[model samples]
Target: MAKPRRGVQFQHRGSNHHNGRRPSISESDSVSEPGSPTGAAMNGKLETSKEEDESPPQSEYEKKKQNFITRAIWTLVMMAAFFTAMFSGHLYIIAIITGIQVMSFKEVIAIANVPSRAKNLRFTRSLNWYFLGTTMYFLYGESVIYYFKHIVLVDKVLLPFATHHRFISFMLYVIGFVFFVGSLQKGHYRFQFTQFAWTHMALYLIVVQAHFVMNNIFEGMIWFFLPASLVITNDIFAYICGIAFGRTQLIKLSPKKTVEGFVGAWVCTIFFGFAMTNVLMRYKYFICPVNDLGANIFTGLECTPNPVFIPQAYHIPSIVTDIPLPGSLHIPSIVHVAPMQFHILVFATFASLIAPFGGFFASGLKRTFKVKDFGESIPGHGGITDRMDCQFIMGFFAFMYYQSFIAVYKANVGDVIQTAIQGLDHEEMVEVVKGLSKHLVNQGVVQETVLECWTGVVGNRR
Candidate 1:
């Protein structure tokens, strides 16, 4: 047979051309077959190129549309959760706020602990968390003491802690500070101290503001609900208005925000705020303070509604109306507007105008860190801090606004009962009743005969 091809000679083993075997092909003469290593690599590259060509990349518009849809769905879910919590009870809302606080703290701490800066530090991470715990304890303790003092003080276990909460909080902080200082290294001092400042700032901004939000809840659900609702409403309207008519950029800090959007949102928010307040004021569940820990939507609560919730008749001024009423005839227009409407307008204004600054501040923070979002905790919504940046500021402002303008001091019977029972022993309580009876008799609020009958009943019980 003709000499076998050099590369194919291996298949004809025993019949050799030289020394019972075919001569090996020279490296220059060898040709790569389709199944060879070089051929397989070329095939793989061709397949990869085909795949890249077949699948088109997503355009910017498509990406934005997908993001918007995702955000809208999650926003609806969040709204559902908020309304469910609002209807559940004040305690449920408090729980939600507390959850938010913890998550926000975690996100902020993660941002502060950059790998390069935190790698050399030994105690920085531990100290940061310790300080967070200490600060949360102090801030949350203050809120509990102020809002739920009755319940806290009456519990024997909680009373001592509640009484010395400030001192205990300070001691806890001091211990952490001492540990932090003791563990400091020569080269890592700057990073450790920077982290220390960052931790406290996060605590103040996140925890302290959130405490005021809880305070707003206790003051009355309306105080919490209306301001929160206004902010949500403003955010929605602002986005809508921005997309529809936005032209001039409002601020450098937030490039997307627009002057038209800002103004339009304010007008729409004011109207929405007024309308929502009108509706919510009619429901005692939405307007009442959480006096009972166990109170819920099912059980309901009863209270003399705040004067703001009560509609008052105001005589219409004749300045705008062409028709003049006779001086003798006092024409009173039966206006069904709540006094809270005026205050809601103020809140709406802030939600539309000033609250956006909080978002701008967050935007600046993200820019400084060169991050797209604070964290990817909320899918399309960025992070909890991003969503709540404006809210904490708004909630704090609502608390201050209520305290300054709208709050009225009304004696609550539950408060009085708690105070009387908290510190008094059985004998002391009996003496208090006796003293109260005599005082009532002296004030003509109780009869001597009634006092005698009460005393006899007490004696029989003993």
Candidate 2:
């Protein structure tokens, strides 16, 4: 009564100030004391969130360590996937190669597409992919016709494709070429032509080379697997050797490459190749040609091993053998080694000494474009092309070497069937079939009645 203190009067009326009524318990709790349980819990949550949001910056060494771990993990993952495809079947391996070819081509062309995009030339990109599809149709068609003629020629659906694949491929390419010419703008002659040449270059460097690698797979799994493994082994050992003992730089294009590492990797690769060949030679799944696309490691294949896989005795030259021995001692006069072991030395040498130049070439290419990598298709690995640069050259060499030195020049059933189907008329084919049936009967490979029935059928048709 004597007019309460101003603060006490305000506090008494504060609850009813909003609507002339006392405030609820929830409203009171909203302005609770700092020492209350709810206030302490709220403060604790804020601190927890702050701690979670703030992470200390990593040092250079820590960043590098993390990168290395990521790289190693991806490496293992790629290897596992590769082996799985290899063991699954030829078709699976072919699918993998095709995927790689497309991805690598995309990465290579994308570098040039940046300028085309800026210039608003959308057709430039379309032309690149058009050319790729055209090239693939030609190359894959050739492989199918050459390797599986028995099936392709007999199937009505596939016969036309097999016989005229090249023509069809050429027509497709010409369409793309005409479209490109029509799409040319007035002020962009030099840039358009440059892109044109770049597209062809990418086709040759990536698609053409990959086609030969695919041929190697059809020739035999070893031709594809061995060379690829050699390249990969050399790359791994080169890095290890470089880190262990490296001083002199091997090439200006690639500063990290060292002479010591190069030489060391050569030695290590040779040993690995020798050992790997020995193991692979024992499995027909690795040595046999792919007669069945569906065949797998478990199903297995049957073929006489290539002569190179067989052990042979090589007489050592006295002068060469005695040089490394003591004056009183002599090395063995003859050493037993598989011929493939000797060939593998050459492969290992190339994989170590020459194949790396492919990587250096890619390095030079990246320098020309002022880029760090071809693409980000693979984490830690950079791109398919980065991993495949050495592989393309190595595979090309393997294909050439196999064709030149290893492949036995002999006619197989597919070759005969292809020649017969293409070279003879329909009537002539019937006659040849009858003649072949009669010949088989004479040889006791077929019953004489079979030839009579075949002759009767042809006679009725005529």
Give the candidate number with the greatest TM-score.
2
Clashes of 2: 0
Compose the digit string of candidate 2's lDDT tens values, residues 1-462: 587566555554675336655656744564465478875775677579878889677899998998889889999999999999999999999999999999999999877666734358767777888899999999999988888888898899999988888899999999999998998888777788988999999999999999999999998899999999999899989999999999999999999999999999999999999899999999999988888888999998888777888899999998877777657786888999888888988899999989999999999999999888999888887989999999999999999998898887778887888989889998888878888898899999989999888888878877
What tens digits encode model 1's per-residue C-alpha lDDT throughout 9-111? 4543645233655545632123335477765675687689879999989999999999999999998899899889888888899999999998998888787
For each of the candidates, give the backbone clash count: 0, 0
All candidates: TM-score: 0.80, 0.87
Off by over 4 Å in 1: 1-49, 321-336, 413-430, 437-462
Candidate 1 lDDT for residue 94:
92
lDDT of each: 0.83, 0.88
Instruction: Name the TM-score of candidate 1.
Output: 0.80
What 10-residue stretch in candidate 1 is worst by lDDT?
23-32
List the pairs of residues colliding in candidate 2. Answer: none
